[model samples]
Target: AQTVTQSQPEMSVQEAETVTLSCTYDTSENNYYLFWYKQPPSRQMILVIRQEAYKQQNATENRFSVNFQKAAKSFSLKISDSQLGDTAMYFCAFTGRGSTLGRLYFGRGTQLTVWP
Candidate 1:
């Protein structure tokens, strides 16, 4: 059983600043995938970033990046140059390969508010 945990329940940041949301997981499998999904007030789950366990380097996408520590089972997300539109509920998710294609285990959630 793989479980993701986001210690921060809520985080706020000023526009154009940077913020990092912490996430940790417990997984016995050596190979798996981690993801960060954002759901705005509209409540649509959007993929923010993803990191494969085998990849040593972190993954970055525009204003979003991830600090993936496979050994520690931690995958935190960093949002740089934040904007008001970034306000949303961020969820950390994990999925094991093989038989778990449609299955995704998510953390409680982290509500991020970007203030102008």
Candidate 2:
């Protein structure tokens, strides 16, 4: 079994500013996928970004980026130019490659508030 942890239960950032959410995981599997997901008030889980365990370079998507450290099993999300739309429940998730395929583990999540 794998476990993901979000140290911060909540965080706040001003509009147009930047904020980072921390995450760490424990997994014995070498091949896997790490992801950051956002769930807004609507309760839709949106994929913010993802990182393959084999990739050394971090993954980025527009204003969202990840700082993935494979050795430390850390995957942090940095949201730039934060907007009111960015306020949501952010989750750190993991999925394995082989036998555990299709199974995803998630952290409790961090509530991010973007203030105007």
With a 3 Å backbone cut-off (N, CA, C), the pairs that clash in candidate 1 are none
Q: Which ten residues in a row have the lowest lDDT in candidate 1?
A: 94-103
TM-score of each: 0.95, 0.97
On the 0 to 100 scale, the lDDT of residue 105 in model 1 is 92
Cα lDDT tens digits, model 2, 3-88, are 89999999999999999999999999999999999999999999999999999999999999999999999999999999999999
After the best TM-score superposition of candidate 1, give how far the Cα of residue 56 lies from its true spot, in angstroms: 0.4
Against the true structure, candidate 1 reaches a TM-score of 0.95
